[model samples]
Target: MSNSARILIVDVEPHIRRLLHGTLTRADYRVTEAGSARQAMAEIEANAPDVVLLDLGLPDRDGLELLPLIQQKSKAAVLIVSARDATDEKVAALDLGAIDYVTKPFDTEELLARVRVALRSRLVADGGRASIEAGDVSIDLVQRRIHKKGEEVHLTPKEFAVVAELARFPGRVITHDKLLAAVWPRDYERHIEYLRVIVRNIRQKLEDDATVPAIIVNELGVGYRLMGVAG
Candidate 1:
């Protein structure tokens, strides 16, 4: 909705870059173009764009390999726009910190919608938001507080840390290793049971029905997901 958002389009094809530049400029967004991973990184370093429309097939390096590097460079949200539509590739990209993914030949409206979501979330993170409203609960990331339907829900410091980590990346899957490393700073490999116990306690306290969890969803052996990030 905001016309002031800046977008960087990274693709190997010249025509694709030209087409995206026209489409985004017509949509009233400031646009930048890069034809290779090296160029993309250069643009990112010189000035970080608000959102990056990245193509996985790059001439210099694979987009998958460059995704994390981009994250390391800036706080910009990455929306993958590649022709690789395989489920595994999508999962891999999201797991690597991509805000969202769109396959090539993507619908104009749908792609724009996803971009809007990414921009909105960036606004939330950048506006000094020390809290999040998820469903009936409010998470105060600053104070590490949780209130359910106007009532305080107490939790241990460790429990709060786990929930906060997942909340940090809404609508994105956080792999087991990433979560464990974040929460269990010292050693996390042998502490899945500890994480599980804490997650169970969190669910019992916050979830309406712990048996059928809605706020915190488990990704089988991967990690937990914080649902209802809309607050």
Candidate 2:
């Protein structure tokens, strides 16, 4: 999180946006606004805001569904600021990696305080895994380390590259050509066997049962996808 702390406000109401925009800017914080989930995602990708003030009443998609997608792309701390005020909604938001859940009719001072805490909190400062989590397995992209059930699991450079490529876009099929290009830059598609071997090795080390793989799933003739929760 930067010192200025860029904040992205995602809400449909123009009055709410104007209020937040004015309030945040007055406090010396850089702020941006979005009217829908699509716009919110675009702003997040373009600006990489330090904290996201999300509303559940998005015009396009539910804020809950957008939370993980935001996690997948950046290390921004999410703050659910919504009118729902439901216990389940709050719990769900927290579980999805939101740092704070502030109701719509909140005090500006309290909201700002929470944002300050979020920027300083371990969740943003230490940056809890800007990678992917599969079951009990964790793939730390920054550290280039893989952990299964809280135990360090080692892999060769090529194997790590294979896993890292899958980690880059979890739950999406990465083609054989893409994996091959990432790991074996000089080698042609003929080197796909190498990728397969490396994936097999990764499964052996990380999966509970390599025979019935779960963490990394094969895409048959295509390539592979990491079945995990993106951080």
Alpha carbon RMSD to native, model 1: 12.5
Our model 2 lands, by Cα RMSD against the true structure, at 11.9
Q: lDDT, candidate 1, residue 13? A: 88
Clashing pairs in 2: none
Candidate 1 lDDT over residue span 1-231, tens digit each: 222457899999898888888887877777899999999998987656879999999988999999999989877889999999999999999999899999888788788888877776665664424568778988865445689999988877677767777777765666777777655656625478878888899999999999999988999988878889773
- TM-scores for the candidates: 0.54, 0.54
For model 2, how does the per-residue alpha-carbon lDDT over 181-214 read when each residue is reduced to its tens digit? 7667555444777888888898899888999998
For each candidate in the order shown, give its overall lDDT on alpha carbons. 0.81, 0.81
* Model 2, total clashes: 0
| Candidate 1, residue 80: how far the Cα is off, in Å | 0.1
Candidate 2 global CA lDDT score: 0.81
Candidate 2 similarity to native, TM-score:
0.54
